[model samples]
Target: MKKNVLRLFVVGLIWLASCSPLTRVLKNPDINEKYQFALEFYENEDYYRAGLVFEDLLPNMAGKAEAENVQFYYSYCQYYQNQFDLAAYYFKQFYDTYRRSDFAEEALYMHAYSNYKATPDYNLDQSNTTKAIETMQDFMNRFPKSSYFEKAGSIINELRGLLEKKAYSIAKQYHRLRRYQAAVIACDNFQKDFPDSELKEEVSFIKMEAQYEYAKASIYTMKIERYEETMEYYYYLVDRYPNSEYMKMAESYFKNTQRELYDLNP
Candidate 1:
């Protein structure tokens, strides 16, 4: 019975504290005491309340030694509270404003991390993912020997994966939609841009298939030249990826191209 009563009492106190007006702290007569309490709240991980207090304390504590920590945590508060875009902005601000401060490196990383958090799945627009890659690459370049090197490299690769997936999806969509001409160009670009991608064999094969389809769909004057070009692509893919899973399907295109060559020439 006593434990139950104590639990209710604690819950009630938390409710009251959360419902309490933040202005009470902002209007406190002693700003120094108010700032100290804000830091205490942040240390306790009550970041919402801490952020409220920090917001009020920022102007007062500017240029002070404590401001460094306050600014750094303010961005973290934004991050923890799930305001990732704002967190990214403020983290960049912290890095720029206190470039020489010990927190600068972490702030830079957090800026990129905030963007990474905002970056969504493969199907969504990937502008934020692109931004994160750029920002993280810059961070890695600037801090090559920093402890975050491996983690940063991992994030860059992850971002590249998203980009590669999106590019492949779009190119494949062109092929699926029967826009074989566009698919040919898109697939070519994808191969050129990401030659080392795991999707290399698939990409090359699809472009070859697209080229064959484009040739078939072309006018009489264009068919011969396009078919010849497709044969070149088929040989290239077979030469490079003899064991490709796509070889069976790619072989069909090659046979069709060969038969059409004789018919077109004859």
Candidate 2:
């Protein structure tokens, strides 16, 4: 049994070694041979090997007649194999190195999509989301006339919403822990950072609530002054988004703050 296992392993190694030399295959008039071999590997689901062969052909094929098709399918092989990061890198190279190619716009879009695929969950690292959004935005800016405009725009909106949600979560956590000063600052930053965000209503509500809580925790003599600041926030919320559900809540707090001032001074 052990001998049979060892024999099988040796046979596999020999097979791989024979295929390894295919990486050196480049464009001659013999491009057809390399293409045929790569197609066989690709159809057999041996994407890694197919990608290897394609990448090797790149430098030699550059400026040659077959460059465009080779680079396009190379990117596709990486993409189809779920190597999104590598696919994104190759797509970027294709876009930059072959700007005049018919595949340029499509390659650019795929570059952005690859990064978008790499984005982590909202609660995890958002670095990829940030990168994805920025890359998509840049792609849109560069290729506004490209067919990818609307798709890229939709991706930008989705990524922006995720980032806003992260900021709101951090601010809310601070508020929930009674870290009033920190919460106030964080909430303020969120409002400024995403002024036109979908989170405007929730942000305004949190800002008002945090201001009121901070006021409630003040010294007795400073309570009136603090309440005055708190009232300003509520009024701001009501004025800025009158139709918001949060406005009704803010109105209740505004009345409460006014009553507190009267009671304290009377």
Candidate 3:
């Protein structure tokens, strides 16, 4: 108990020592002094207090040369605090207001990167993901020789992969729910949208299976056409991936579909 009490006392004293400077600066009448202390806090990685000090200095520093630095560092404060949406907003604001400033290029990149960090998982809404891609693309177009160009390309590819995974999941979900017609349509759309996806084999199999199931449930007049569509998908799958892991199930569906077509034509 004595040791624990001593440790707590030491921690409390350190906390007070740290807080005193910020408290004194906030009360100081000299704006320059406060600005210097804010930069000190920011350099020391004390973003929360630095943000407070910077926020206080912004209105007074307007039209002064210090305003630009204050705005740039304030956006970084939000970013380091993981307030990504707010970071994106402030970073964009900084770049727009200081287009010719030395930090403008970095600020614009951070704006798009903040949106990328704000994007949700593959299953959630992806509006921000799309926005991040567009903003990053704009950055690349504006600064083709930037050091951030390669990194921006990588981010776009990763986000596109997320979108592809989401699309594939939705198509699979439709198939799982026995919405075979919708599943076939969704699978076709996914194929068209992501022609080079690694999931193409599985998607092709699912499309074929879904079409076969739909044909099985259709009326006599529609069964032949639907089954013929299934055969086309199966052939495409086999032609592209003859050694696919899904070939066994795909062949079973193909054989069953062919039997049906034969029965209908006979």
TM-score of each: 0.86, 0.76, 0.85
TM-score pick, better of 1 and 3? 1
Tens digits of per-residue lDDT, candidate 2, 162-191, equal 888888888989998999878989989998
Error of 3 at 143 (Å): 0.9
Better of 2 and 3 by lDDT: 3
State residue 56's C-alpha deviation in candidate 3, in Å: 2.4
On a 0 to 100 scale, what is the lDDT of residue 195 in model 1?
88
Compare the candidates by lDDT and give the number of the best one. 3
Runs of candidate 2 with Cα error greater than 4 angstroms are 1-32, 43-46, 59-63, 218-226, 242-252, 255-266
| Candidate 1: tens digits of C-alpha lDDT, residues 112-201 | 889989998988899999999999998999899889989999999998999999889989999999999999999988988798999989
Among all windows of 10 consecutive residues in model 1, the one with the lowest summed lDDT is: 18-27
Please give the ranking of all candidate structures by lDDT, highest first, separated by commas: 3, 1, 2
lDDT value, residue 127 of candidate 2:
92
Clash count for candidate 1 is: 0
